[model samples]
Target chain A: QTASPAVAKPSRLGLCASCHGETGMAVMPGAPNLAGQRLDYLRQALKDYRDGRRDAPVMRAAIGPIGAAELDALARWYSAQAPAAASAP
Target chain B: QTASPAVAKPSRLGLCASCHGETGMAVMPGAPNLAGQRLDYLRQALKDYRDGRRDAPVMRAAIGPIGAAELDALARWYSAQAPAAASAP
Candidate 1:
């Protein structure tokens, strides 16, 4: 599925960019860098949000309206991005 | 803050564990493995969901009620966990 501007606009993932950065890197404290993250894992996360198996009011709301096709596009987009320099000390 | 049973229970991140596997690995298709992921990155993702920047409807809902403290705990939990075998083929 292709990510349309209306569908995949940064607004959808804008809050994500705050900590995940525009490219999925952790730009803030306590956030995990998502650049170069595995596609399988990203997809599962989207599913978890949809199923309500995971608990996070904010996450559930963000992913509430998205469909599987869009989720796939998001996973692919973030997974394909390069990871930021390892901040692990 | 410590992860309480009601607070930091797997239910909150349960859906995440599915593709992320119990250990944050990508056990399913289109998911990204989060094991061994940077703690900073995870925190950012939670924030994104809370802020509505990310486009996944499911994720926003999942992270809706989570506070920063809990988000930190979740990030630490996943980041500290070991990553499963790389499926990056």
Candidate 2:
């Protein structure tokens, strides 16, 4: 029997997984955890980053040219995630 | 009978609560959430801010003069907190 391909979880956070872990925990101190944020908040923030309302060098590069619908999808994916409980590193 | 003062939770995140929320969830887009981060990462971050290794204007001001023990305490408190689940805002 052939093994099934690993299922991809629904998320628009593809690039976000670099500094922010695949699970939404931030891998770098400079990065913020994205899990469990308010969807509206994340949406607005993304908009701001795209429009230069927020001055984040890293974010500016990361958010380059992505438009609205996908932004919403990203927000939906991240906001839907519940951050896991603290545990040993 | 005197009511006892509300007991302070153990944390060095006093100023952090202004933007990061009392619960380690960041209120601002530019600010990163701290919940569920590894303790060592958090400690190193706070130290970076304190020592000018990190260039954050707000953090530079916030981390002024705190001792090593307090930075450790802050990391401990924050890392111990599991971010609450996502819910409708």
True contacts recovered per prediction: 0.47, 0.45
**Which structure among the candidates has the greatest lDDT?**
2
Clashes of 1: 68
Question: Which candidate number would show the highest DockQ if scored against the true structure?
Answer: 2
Off by over 4 Å in 2: A1-19, A26-33, A37-76, B1-11, B27-30, B87-89
| lDDT (10s digit) by residue, model 2, range A3-63 | 1123234455668778766656667756766666667777877888888866568889988
**Which candidate number maximizes TM-score?**
2
lDDT of 2: 0.67
Report the Cα lDDT for residue B39, model 1: 65
| Reference-based lDDT, residue A77, model 2 | 64
lDDT of 1 by residue, B1-89 (tens): 12223323444577666655666656666655566577656777778778876546656655677877777877777666654323471
DockQ of each: 0.23, 0.28
Which window of 10 residues has the lowest lDDT sum in candidate 2 chain A?
Answer: A1-10
Chain A TM-score for each of the predictions: 0.72, 0.79
Query: What stretches of model 1 exceed 4 Å from their correct place?
Result: A1-11, B1-36, B40-89
lDDT of 1 by residue, A1-89 (tens): 12223324444577667656667656766655566677666777778778875556766766776787778877766676654333461
